[model samples]
Target: MSSLENILYFQSALGFLANMVLLLFFIFIILDHRPKPMDLISFQLTFVHIMMFLIGGNSWLADIFESLNIKNDIKCKVTFYSSRVMRGLSICITCLLSVAQAVTISPSTSLLAKFKQKHKKYIINALFYIWILNLSVSSDMMFYVVGFTNVSETKQMQVTKSCSLLPMSSIIRGLNFTLSTSRDVFLVAVMLTTSTYMVNILHRHQRKLKHLHSISHLRASPEKRATQTILLLVLVFVVMYWVDIIISLTSFLLWMYDPVILTIQKFVIYAYPTITPLVKISSDKRIINVLKSLQSKCHQIF
Candidate 1:
């Protein structure tokens, strides 16, 4: 493999492993009956990311499918459709994560606080709807993707070595773009609004903490820590998400995909998923404590 290919594979491997570990931790949390409202969301996010890596892993799966004697069109359709669905789910879940955290930290008298007692039900319902929406929104992938044959066709947007996006009519393209852009804009707007609210709450909370005690005596609560971690995640996600969008827009305008640009876009796409698990592992006291306890037990056994 070329250097670029090697690097991309390494990136995919790292992200897949990190997400897997985080998924396991979230599962443990849920099974132990100690899960916070956001735990379920995080678990779903981790799973979606894992799927992202598996489906879009530098088109490695394409080669595997070929080796397995899968038909070209079937493989292309399956791969692209699944990839689009997972990508949609990632953004939706991340947005939901931010909103859920905002509700979680809302003051008891606040409007959002009413949902707190029944937040799990609301979250479950939201997830169901999100799945339905994304599945429908990304349905276009099945129609547009085909097995690449190096046909030198302008209407085909080469996605992987094996899969290309077949062009649609101007009206169809416009409709698809409008729907996609609208969905993304609405989700991102919600994410940012909640994030801003969280910042305000954190700021006011810091003031109260300062009034109550000296800096040395003040410690962050678990809730504060989780909120801060999520804020950081949201910031990272928004940056990466926009970068991906800009690349997509550039690709669309040019009506072509430059290989180098496509590679960079993939890197940007996976950046958030790779960093998310590391950030959560470091910032979450629960995960940290679990790791420490496991280490202690290992030492005693040795």
Candidate 2:
């Protein structure tokens, strides 16, 4: 395999394994005791990332289809449509996570506190709506994407080796772009707003804690750490999301993708999902305690 293909496979494999581990950890937590709303959100996010890796893997389903001699058009529609839906879910879930964490860390006296008691129910309902919205919004992919042989050479906008996007009328194209851009912009705006609110709350909280405890005794609280981690994820998502958008727009306007740019785009696209599980594993105290327990057991065996 070429170096490019190798790198793609490496990314897909690494992300798949990391998300799987994170998902298992969440499952352990949920099954062991009452699962928190945060845990549920995280579990869903990890699952989405896993699906993304599986669908987009360099040597996975696409290769399977090729080996089975599936029709190229069927392959294009299935792969592209699935990948697009997962991408939509990734952003929506990330946004939901940010908002949920903000609410999680809100002061009890604050207005957001009321929802805390019912957060799990609200989260479940929100997730249902998000899935329906994204699934419907991305339905256009199935219509516009086709096998390379289905479209004329001049009209083809290649997305993959076998898949190309068929051109649409100007009105349809404009409306599609508007719908997609509006959804992304609204979600990102919500993420930023919630992130700022969380930071303010943390600052006020630290000040109060400072008055009650010595500086050395005031370790980072679990709430603060969780908020910080979610903030970091939001920042990463925003950066990657816009960069992906820019690349997509440039390619759309030119009706062609530069190979190097495409590679970089995929890197940017996968970076957030790849890093999220690692961040959670490192930050969660429960996971750390479990790891320590396992290590002690291993030493005893030796």
Candidate 3:
């Protein structure tokens, strides 16, 4: 057994435990009977946990086949492409949340000022589009991605059939990189832009108010809190994703295998999902209260 296998085993085990915790949290939220936004965010977090599980399990699944002769198998395709679907949807969900809040908080006379109030009922329809759009775009992943045997001719390396992109020529590689990363870039850009716009709106509103300590200034406390939470979420996502992109580019240029980068990359892949629930709990009063009540009951039982 190599360090790679060991790390993979550790990652899968750790991720499984985290995923279960998230599942329990989701169930608890639903049982708590909260309404609208919290419920929606809880469901979204549940999807994120599932996404991490599906992607992280690749390590364990790779270890199952002792040899490195993976082909274009249907099972491999399902596992690999399904994760893509969830990944895309996760990003879109965040983008929607950011933009929705932006619209909700727009100046009263603006065109989209009442968009949130008017269209809150159509959230289900919006979510359906997110799922369909992600699933459709990610369909190409099943064809291009597969379990491939990495056989090194120049050096002695273990041949493993890991879930990765097909061994393609330079042209194909360029095309894939351009198309996929372009989509990701667009989504991330929209997310960040909307977040910034929301922040700007809040700042402007604060400046226009006469008294900072007056209740008039504090009437939008909920909005202020929500903005802060969304800003934190956006910051975390940007830092993690951009660093991952940088490391990916550097790794592509490197000559030898650096386990450090590989390890960091793997950890970062799971970092957002792991931190997401905790972040939500810290920022959300409803989830916080629910957790506190559960804690009190547990203490009494023990």
Candidate 4:
């Protein structure tokens, strides 16, 4: 097999393993909670991420099978379509999560604060809209994607029999890129802005506590901890996502499919879902307690 094929296989295997770990962590979070609004959003994101891993991983696996003279068009198409849907949904859900987090941290006096009280139903509604919007936008791919044989002549190769919204005419591709980039920028801005305000609020609250000689300074209250955790997660997300974006954009502008850029993008995309579970484990006492209980039970069983 060619070196390019070998690298693809290795990256896909790594992504699959990482996604499995992320799935297990999110499952732990779900089993330990009664599905708060935030939990629901996290669960949705995790599910999509797993779907992405499966779809992308399967495509790579299919390549290996084909190289060994095995043909499975049905499996290839299924993997391609599933991957497309999952990727679209992943992007939509990321935006939903940012909006949800912003609403959660909004001041009670702010109009957005109403979401805190009435979020469950609204979240359901918004999720429905996101799925519909993504499905509509990505439907064009179903017509263009054919198996490897069809794309063997093209510079932009298809890993499997899947269609992407990306390999269109330059004008169309630019439009799609603009839309995707704008959505990401807007979501990141919202997350950073709301998180910054929340941190400031927590800081002011801390200063007020300092003025009270009767009250002792604590390590960190639940609200403060949550605020800090959210801030850290957002920072990690912004840095990782923008780095991937910059690499991708630079590659596109240079009209080159640089292997280094592809590798970095793959890692960032695979790692994104792991962040939420890590944030919860670090910030939520209930989740930590559940993990501890599970560990003790396992030890006893052994």
Candidate 5:
């Protein structure tokens, strides 16, 4: 196996491990409480996105097996479109989370702050709309994505049963690309604006509480803590996402297959789902308590 193949396997295995951990995190969170709408959404996103990655990864591995004289070809529009929908939802959730955190740190007198307070009950409805929008945006994939088939009599160099985009009008492809890129750019812009505001808020908060604070000087209000956690998530996400996007775009533009870039791309894509659960559980006392109790019970059983 070449270096690229080895890296591909490594990336796949890493994603599998991260998915298993996130799966457990979701299970424990659900078991710990009657899952709220947002909780359910997180669970759905984590589970579905990871599964999509696995399916995509398996599709790639099928290509590898074919190269080695094995017969395998599995690719369909459902898997392709499902992944796109889940990815869009993931991006949407991150934007929403950043907005929520920014709202928390906003002065209660602000109109945005007031709106958030008044519409707290409507969060699920808003999220539902987001789901609907993503589904609608990705619906085209169902018709356009088709399983890649062997072009020759003998299988060669088909390391994956990749899907080919169906021939469509240039106008339609351009529109689709524009729409998807706009969605990502818009959310990223939202996150950056809110994140800048949050930094100012945290600075002021820290200054105001400086004298009254304890030894480590790290004691922060719950709102501040939550905002900080979210800021961290957003920062990490932006860095990973943009780097992945840049590499991806460049690779397409240059028609290059650099393994390092490919590995980094997968890692960047996987980073958020891998890190989100840890951040969430750390932020929630209930999750921590449940985790501790479970750990103690496992000890007792062993």
Candidate 6:
């Protein structure tokens, strides 16, 4: 196999492995004695991550299909649409997760805290809307996507099928790009602002507690732990997303549509969702206990 094929294979294997681990981690979280609201959110996030991985894995499979000279139109469309929907869903859920965490950690005086009693229910409602919004924005792509045979002659020599948005006037393409970019920037700003507020509140809360007690450690409290976990999750999300945005923007500005850059973008996008469940498992005591119990049961069975 060529180097490109090998690279795709390795990446696909890694993505699949990560998805399996995330699935197992979330399962343990769900089986825990007392799952928290955050744990449930993490569970839902990880489920979406698994779907993202599966969708990404299809890209690698498409490569393999090309290597085998399999030219199937239905397979191409299914892969294309599934990947697009999964990507859209992943982005929406990630923003939702950030908003959920912010609400969870908001100070009592904050307007968001007024809805504390109904936070989980609100999150559920928000999640429903996120999926709907994503679907509405992306559904038009269904009419535009076509397999290899339908693309321009310049791209016809490519073995793997191409799925692209239909050609539009330059003005229309510009408008589409502008709208998409504006929405993305707005969501990113919201996530960043909310995360920053949460971190500041957590810091002030920790300092206040520290001043009140010199002899007692402040790290052992459930609230403190939850705050730390959310902060860490937010930090990870921000860093990964910003890196992706930088790379994507550079690629777009340079007009360099290299497959390698696209590959890297896919890696980052898939990695974001997949890591969330594992992070939750590592930080959550109840999930750790459940995983331990499962390990013990498996050993006994063996």
Q: Could you estimate the TM-score for every candidate?
A: 0.92, 0.92, 0.77, 0.74, 0.76, 0.80
Q: Candidates ranked by TM-score, best first? A: 1, 2, 6, 3, 5, 4
Write model 4 residue lDDT over 137-221, tens digit each, in one string. Answer: 6665455455545433464544323432235577865775787678778777877777777777777777787777546665787
Winner on lDDT between 2 and 4 is 2
Error of 3 at 149 (Å): 3.0
Q: Rate the local accuracy (lDDT) of all candidates.
A: 0.86, 0.85, 0.66, 0.66, 0.68, 0.65
What are the per-residue Cα lDDT tens digits for candidate 5 across 1-302?
Answer: 36755765676666566666656867877886676544555566567557656765656655655687653222355556667787788888888877766665687777677756544455667678988998888877567655655425322222123544445565775676677778899999999999998898888768767756644467567777777778888888888888877875675443345445656666677677667666766686655677688899999999
Q: RMSD to native for every prediction?
A: 2.2, 2.4, 4.7, 4.7, 5.1, 4.0
Number of the top lDDT candidate? 1
Per-residue lDDT of candidate 3, residues 173-289 (tens digit): 566667877887898999888888888888877877745555454555777888777778777877888887777666543323455566667667666666666666666676667
Clashes of 2: 0
Report the Cα lDDT for residue 58, model 5: 58
Better model by lDDT, 3 or 6?
3
Number of clashing residue pairs in every model? 0, 0, 0, 0, 4, 0
* Regions more than 4 Å wrong, model 4: 1-33, 59-81, 142-144, 149-153, 157-167, 213-217, 295-302
The residue-by-residue lDDT of candidate 6 on 48-82, one tens digit each, is 66676766667666777788887665556667666
In angstroms, give how far residue 25 of model 1 lies from its true place: 1.0
Index of the highest-TM-score prediction: 1
Q: Write the per-residue lDDT of candidate 2 for residues 55-90, one digit (tens) a residue.
A: 776357767888999987888888888888999999
lDDT score of residue 58 within candidate 4: 69
* Cα lDDT over the full model 4: 0.66
TM-score of 3: 0.77
- Ranked by TM-score, the better of candidates 2 and 3 is 2
